[model samples]
Target: MSTTTQNRLESRYAGITLEGYPHALSAWFIVALRFVMGGMILFAGLGKLAFVSGEPFDASGFLVHGVDPASPVSGLYAAMASNVALMEIINVVVPITQVLIGVALITGAFVRLAALGGAMQMAMFYLGGWEGQWLAAFDSTLIYALVFLALGAFAAGRIAGLDRYIEQIDVGGEPLVERFPTLRYLLG
Candidate 1:
């Protein structure tokens, strides 16, 4: 049977108080979300590498023409597209990085780092694929970025994932995270 926990969360900043809000959530639900997100990302990377179009993955065309000209970073995209060396590097890096991030999230290894990377990638995609209307640009990439951020904030990996084990790894007779406190930023 799955269990839910009640939590009261609050925050304060700039002389304003965000009152504690009581909420109930199931850890299993978070694990499921993590799995679904990881699987989708993994498949996306694999699809790129598998190349259903029988052509190597390339970002040049997308960078040059797919992006909306009115996007704030359109010039940056065009510059990147025009640089042969950079494009080549990007072509090879994107899919591999996606795969790595997917695996890390799935396995719950270095989840914070993976989440950060995933969020950054999604942010870039959100900016790159803007469709002109600033207010109407709430898209999948932005949602994905938020999801990644939430996962990191909640330390989802610790809730039934390898991160729970990794955090306890013994280092010189003490738990790894405890021994190196800063590792908390990367592990959970």
Candidate 2:
């Protein structure tokens, strides 16, 4: 049986109480979510790497015409598509970065950094595929970005991931995070 603990959260900003609430979460659920998300992203990268298509991947066409014309960032997408060097860089970087992020999340290594990258990618996708309607704009990309943020905030990797052991590595008789406090921002 899972045990429940009482936890209170409070936050204030600019002389105002933003939030004061009690919340509970299941540790196992978070771990499962991480795995599922990682697998989905991994397969996506693999697909772009020719696992799904027999031909090479190209983002120029998507950047040129796939984006909704009414989207706020359509001009940006068009500009990106117009640049040959940038397109070449993006075509390779997108898939490779996705694979790296997926591996990091699955192995529970540098999860915070991976989550940041994932969130940023999802944000770009969300903006690139803008639906023009406010309600329609809240799509899977937005949800994925939020989920990545939540994973980083909760340090889900430590629950049953390699990060737990990584965090305990001795560095000059002190834990790695203790020795290098800045690492806490990258690994969790």
Candidate 3:
């Protein structure tokens, strides 16, 4: 191509050099989303953690708070509400899983694993009882779930996080993959 043509192309596109982001500055937007989502997930876990302070968070509230006729999953949640053993187990699992997922997402270590877990959690919330008007577009929980899944699919963490460094390391005795084979699916 001629220098003039190349210059024109560069000028037209300006800073944005990647797909999905229109402007050069917009590429960071992806990482920014990851940060925001990670922070929220982390805080959410803390909010449910009992020893932190005040009243302990109880997962049973998920079922108790809603008896809405419109919610199709209300019956399932109601059934869970009756089982003390299950509720107790869920109460413990929810916070722990959320914390793990949050930490993974924040550090961009095993991002795909974190995102997949986040997606599952959000999907549960959406199905259990996310009160919203969108029957077609999707509610906040579902949106977050999709976001998590998308991040995983793209390995969005490699953008500006520790996952990039983790991808580079290797030892003679055992490759990173050999030590943690499942990480192959989780980290990108």
Candidate 3 per-residue C-alpha lDDT over 1-188 given as tens digits, one digit per residue, 9 for 90 to 100:
22322211122256655443244543377688788888899889888887774677776776867545457778788888889999889888888888888888778888998999999999878877655456643778888999999788767778787787786678566667667777778785
- TM-score (all chains, Cα) for each model: 0.89, 0.88, 0.77
lDDT per residue (tens digit) for residues 79-167 in model 2? 99999999989988988888988998898888899899999999988888996999898899999999998889878778788888888
- Ranked candidates, highest lDDT first: 2, 1, 3
Write the number of the candidate with greater lDDT, choosing between 1 and 2. 2
The global C-alpha lDDT for each of the candidates, from Candidate 1 onward, is 0.84, 0.85, 0.77
Least accurate stretch of 10 residues (summed lDDT) in model 3?
1-10
Candidate 1, 1-188: lDDT as tens digits: 42364466677899888865443455667778788888888777877784653668998888998888888888999999999999999998888888888998888888888889889989988888997886878999999999998888778789878889999999999999999999899887
**Model 3: which residue pairs collide?**
15-24, 16-24
Q: Against the correct fold, how does model 1 do in TM-score?
A: 0.89
Candidate 2 Cα errors over 4 Å, as ranges: 4-25
State the local distance difference test value for candidate 3: 0.77
Question: What does candidate 2 score on TM?
Answer: 0.88
